[model samples]
Target: MTDVEPSTEITGNMQQLIAAKAEELFNLCDTEQKGFIIKKDMQRLRDELGVEPEQLEDVFDSLDIDHNGYLTLEEFTSGFGMFLGDQIDDGNANEQEMIEHNPNDKEEQQLFHDTLEALGAKDLYDDEETIMGLWMKLRENDPVLLRQFEQFIGKITQEIRRSKLDHRSIEAALHSKSSVHESEIKKLYDEMEQQIKAEKAKVLAQEKLKERELREQMDRELRLKEQQLSELTKKQSDLEMKLLRLNLNESETKSENERLQKGLKNLANI
Candidate 1:
């Protein structure tokens, strides 16, 4: 059987598959529903994937790209791609090389050159200082563009790692002449779909419950307010009645005083 290398499209699909699996593993580890995973969560991954503690620690460190004591989804996905690349290469050679390699190395410089060519900025490649100045300018003036550029570079790097991982698997699948690998891929996707649906349903149910509770509380408050309004109306009516009675009593007393003054005047004339 002829050896076959995976195409770019195939590599992308495999990367997506790996990312999906990583997300699933991340969700499992993050049992508390925190959006990020801490080092403590690595234990869950080790338990589930049956990886060694030391290996898990190494993976966690590599995956936490920002070293912020937590792993975001993007970091986990990209780091897992690299880890799979290492696995495909049959050892920690690639990982060790990455650790030992200098940023100013020829290969790294070549990568920058290729990147500049791809970006149609080859004119800037000859002047490292200019490139640095441009990068700093973007960072300061156009932060969003800088962020997008960083993300694009990260994706390209991740794709390269995934291609290396998929290369051997594609070759093996071609040699075996069996559909087992395809079937496994399908099964994993099906499971992931079901799990995602279940999680969505759970969230919907919680939201509905929250809405119902809020509606009930609002209804109770409305009823209490209505009752208080009714009591206030009654109190106001009682006060108005008391005021009318007081006015009537004052009129009666004034009339009786006027009559006594007239009788006293007649007695004075007699």
Candidate 2:
């Protein structure tokens, strides 16, 4: 039933009729006066009230909005609004067709009052606003349309629930993948860091080895320089000694030549 706006006007007689039906259904369904009726007990209402089996599910679902499996007077009255205007079938082609219950009929009048007394909706009967409010809650005139609306709402609700579940599943999968990727990235970073440290250590060790080699080479060069200097000093001292011996030999030769010249001059005088 397509829910229409409650813009329809209720004449005084129409008000009385709706009130009577509301009270009747309430009493019939809530016979125990427990203030509510279970889904099973609603079969009486479905059978007697001329509600179709297919439509009943939607009606039950709509009336039992709380999903508590029971119908209060308020819920029952709202359901009554669905079937109030006309007979629940294709036989009555006129949407304007209304059941005219005579207020003057003694049996029907007493039944309406008895229903009110049993259910305590006397205030509802007296107040036009309250009765209209209940009537206005019905959006659709056709039972099939009303049931279709209910089914449509049910489908939409189901879809919403399914979407929420899907969203949660996607979030969980993304979270799992994110966690795995983060772990892999951290492992790779750690391996890279270790490799860098090892390379640095290797390079540092090589540099240190090169420095030691250079130091050893310098020490050897210094020792060779010292040895060459010692040998040159020893050679200079030996050259000085040889020059002194040559000077002494030259002086002795000059003295012997002078002595020989004096001997030759004495022999010429003899």
Residue 105 error, candidate 1, Å? 74
* Residue-level error in angstroms, candidate 2, position 203: 2.1
Give one digit per residue, the lDDT tens place, for model 1 in 35-75: 88988788886545556777678779977877899997777
- lDDT (10s digit) by residue, model 2, range 1-270: 223322234344334454455667678767788988887666666654456765666667876877888888776765655544322222123232322212234664465455344443444433333232222233323445534334323343444557778999999999999999999999999999999999999999999999999999999999999999999988888888787778777877877887888889889899
TM-score of candidate 1 versus the correct structure, residues matched by position: 0.34
Misplaced by over 4 Å in model 2 are 1-162, 249-270
Question: In candidate 2, residue 114 scores what lDDT?
Answer: 52
Q: Against the true structure, what is every candidate's RMSD?
A: 30.2, 16.5
Global lDDT scores for all candidate models: 0.64, 0.58
User: What clash count goes with each model?
Assistant: 0, 6
Candidate 1 local lDDT, residue 172: 80
Q: Give the worst 10-residue stretch by lDDT in candidate 2.
A: 94-103
Give the candidate number with the greatest lDDT: 1
TM-score for each candidate, following the candidate numbering: 0.34, 0.39
